[model samples]
Target: MRSRRDDVDDAAAVERALRLGLVGMGEATDERAERRLDRFIAAPDGAFVWTRDGDGAAYVGRITGPWRRDEDGAAVDLVNVRDCDWVTEPVDPGLIPAAVAQTFARGGRNFQQTHPGDVEAQTQTLWLRLAS
Candidate 1:
């Protein structure tokens, strides 16, 4: 469900909207959104996250700080954000794991955990390579 208060970037505003049923969401939808938000908030520091920009440039980063509402991010519709140490270069498409590539191809707004045991192993290997 699209937030009715999309223009309001603060977490408080978003919470208010959700709690007040102002976003035109059914109970189940609101619960799902809350769960997603809670997961994001609970993500530990140093966890890796992969994302793509509007132009489809892929990036990977390690979360460096807790989640917060950043008004500056409103322009990109990413008000709820965490500080991250993003890799300086865009991830080379060829190096992206099949699982991750598929995830990106599917395209969803919320963050999702990449799956399959092999994908985790592949990501660790890639992370080590990038570190060196």
Candidate 2:
């Protein structure tokens, strides 16, 4: 059995990871995925949440729209963008725009009601490939 010291060390490591700005998605199972999804929805000021991919590279994104439940599962407005600070030099996180979030909310509502499957709707989902 692991000692108390070992448990403390593990907790410290997880804290450091979160401070490094990457939230742990402990194993990519359906339960964890749903939990992470809830977290994205809970982020204050609509900041993007970063998570490690299968290859150990981190990706950043935010929920650009409201959550909707379909036959497959629940889907939300997803904007897969690079953390601007990581892409460039680090800067103050507070400088990020709150206005941009409104645009995302409007887009998501309009898309869901009017054009659920339009080809141009793909543009609504932004995907930026970050440089390693």
Candidate 3:
């Protein structure tokens, strides 16, 4: 099994592939894209979302500040979106890439995040990164 670190890397690669695919398909162009990349790179925080193990109910949560490492040397993944007063909705995991692209195009910061469902191609979280 791959470590969580590897999983994160894989997710990032997949996201990059998706973005590039979008651009190749002409959905993304250079005309107004520089601002989007700049916006994403400048963000200090990112939104969080996740799904439960049994039922694939998707939920959106507030930004949990910046990325950090725990004392155990493990990277802190994300806050429990399930624990907060988050918004729940039904979403198809396959559609995440497009959503993320849309977010970036609108000058929102976000990156690919790993989830149990994503590994299984079931459901995944779309972390919408935004400037604090």
Predicted structure with the largest lDDT when compared to the true one? 1
Question: Scored by CA lDDT, what does every candidate get?
Answer: 0.58, 0.30, 0.30
Tens digit per residue, CA lDDT, model 1, 1-132: 123344533344333333322211211147677787777778788777776543566656667777676564344344566666666666788988899899878755555678865877777678778856
What local lDDT does model 3 show for residue 89?
A: 43
Arranged by lDDT, best first: 1, 2, 3
Off by over 4 Å in 1: 1-29
List model 3 lDDT by residue over 63-131, tens digit each.
334332122212222211111223334344554444433433453223334443333232223332211
Single out the weakest 10-residue window by summed lDDT for candidate 2.
72-81
Clashing pairs in 3: 109-129
Q: Model 3: which ten-residue window has the lowest total lDDT?
A: 19-28
Instruction: Report lDDT (Cα) of residue 71, candidate 2.
Output: 24
Clashing pairs in 2: none
| Candidate 3: regions farther than 4 A off | 1-43, 46-54, 71-132
Candidate 1: C-alpha RMSD after superposition? 8.6
Residue 121 shift from truth in candidate 2, angstroms:
30
